[model samples]
Target: MSAMVDTPAPAPHPVPRRTDGSSVPIGALVPLTRPGWVEAGRHLLAGIESGVRDVNDSGGILGRPVELVVRDTAADPRRAAAAVEELAALGVAAVAGEYHSVVARAAAARADALGLPFLCSSAVLDALTDRPTDWVARLAPAQSHGWRIYGEFLLGAGHRRIAVAAQQSVYWASGTRVLREHLAAHGGTVVEFDMDALTPSAVCDALVDHGATALLLLTGLPEPAVSIVRSVRGDRRLDGVMMGAPAGQPEFGTWAALLGEDGAGIPFLRYLPERLGPLGARVGTALRERLGEAPSFVAFEGYDTVAALADLLGTGEVGRERIAASWAGVAVEGTRGPIRFSRVPGIGVRQWAWPPVQVVDRDPAAPGRFRVLRTG
Candidate 1:
């Protein structure tokens, strides 16, 4: 983790736009480069851009076309903080978009200090801010909210002994804690597997030694997780041991491309209903066209971020101060469901209270299809 700092250094160049005074610029912070989960960033940006088009097509925010001043955080905490400062300096009305939770925390802290209204698109770390502040709000369900549900699902499935293999991250650590706390209350226990200390085979052995009925990959993609999943699947020693990823790794195309059927049946958290409503279906169609594939829930989160902001920006006064002050009254039919913000207990910033949380997985028979295992 790089040290976070708040200085307005120019980040990546913005997407070319006109100076003709027809657009309203909103600063977008996305992880477009390595170490940042580029796949998720692409979906998030597509959803945001699609939402901008939708808002402009309907009637631009206050009848002005929205312009995105994009900055690639590249999964660095310091970079995200700097991007937020730069976006503020560039006179963006609000800041939005980030897939990584630690990066989002850096951006949130900077935005709070700078008095910028940030509607975080994704990133569900429970403590996004250290103290109460009116400048930041989030559209994603908090880690505790979603992970507790996942814990319940695990318990209901008759798994009392769970093993969590996690990378060294505040986000991952927070998720592990959530699961441990939730599971402990119901006579379930979480065994922590230090990712730095275990090889894929050792992980399987550890699972056998601990008698962990379920294994959760609280890790990053494409290296340890992918290799671990492959190892676990191939090891006949681990037959019938359920695999899980509450971080929602298998929701992306990259997972299937890398793991194929190996990624199947690994239930993960996603914030969408089992079925789409009219608005969700309409937006989903456009997002699918723009992304040229089925968009993930992160995409809807991006779209919902803009939709919520557009409603507030369109209906009333505009500025950082006004936007920050007006979070309590936000109500719009989001692509997921009706969006509303409130101060949740133990959560610092205004949160959507929750989006639809579901535990879904790729159908083992068909890797391209997802099966909704549980919904709440």
Candidate 2:
């Protein structure tokens, strides 16, 4: 019998890997060209890119690096929805990043319908999270929580009568309603004004006439917030009145630069805590190096969103259901602090329940020195 030549064992096929060793594809939807949100979009993109770098540097998730696919939504709801569809078509494992609440709303709906996980980076409108979806979560605090914190700060500072200058929009309306309700329940009064209709001088006159000890600017636009600040500061009558702008927190430095000395002593609801941990410091430094400016709250949110997604994807399961289940119980240390999510009744179902937010006073002596006055 001829000795059968044993066939050499077939060589095992090498496991496939991406050129960069990345296995997960994530989409980032940002407003890169919109008039009001362009600068903010750049900042958020920087943070998200930095987060992706950090994740890869740390050996990546499950040994597979993450690839970021960027899409510009331009803060338009239709464009945002289209972007979501495009990302889905690209086969991205998840979608993240949106600066405008309107854009986020549209993007969230599309992502939900496609069964893609979406992590909202900075949109604060409370209604964004009103319905609990298996795939939607937010890293930023809701506007309701932000307004409640603002109310507490104003009331705590002994301001009985507050004047609010707000634009007519769903975002502003929701925030004002929360602020008004909170203040009214706490023996404080709110005098509202149409931000567009009233000139700076007229707003000051109304505040003076109403005997308002504080001014809460909720215009939801940085340019208007800066304009109001300038107007209020120009008039000596409103000099002693405390000024707070919950809408302008992300652009505090810009307002400070425009207001010069006037920006000092003004407080805003800062989503990022004044204090930073070791990881936070590293991310902040990286952001400053990349953006040539101090990181804003939105930047932190963007970074935290990517970090959370990395955590969720690292579990070796990549899909809407798997990510949702993993994310619902995720508690990772973020740039601000411990990041966690829970069902927020009357708000979003599963949202970042406890974002470490603070009321920061801008200091002219130190342009980026965020002095924490109150924390929540």
- lDDT of every predicted structure (CA atoms): 0.88, 0.78
lDDT string for model 1 (1-376, tens) is 1232333322333222334557778999999999899999999999899888888888787667888899999999999999988888887878899999999999998888777788898999988987777888999999999999999899989999999998788898999899999999988899999998889899999999999999999888988999999999999989989999999999999999999988999999999999999999999999999998999999999999899988866655545676677888889999998999999999989999879999999999998999998988
Error of 1 at 92 (Å): 0.7
Task: Report the lDDT of model 2 for residue 198.
Answer: 88
Q: Write the per-residue lDDT of candidate 2 for residues 1-376, one digit (tens) a residue.
A: 0121222222221223345655777899998995547878988899899999999899877788888999999878888989988988787878999998878988887776666788899888887733456668888888888779878988889997988888877787888788889989978888888977987778888988999999887765466777788888888887789888776553545666677677777778878765688999989999989988887877888899988888777665534566666776677889988777777776643588878878878776875566788988
TM-scores for every predicted model: 0.94, 0.89
> For this target, which candidate reaches the highest TM-score against the unseen true structure?
1
Error of 2 at 290 (Å): 0.9
List candidate 2 segments past 4 Å from native: 1-22, 220-222, 364-368
- Candidate 1 TM-score versus the reference: 0.94
lDDT of 1: 0.88
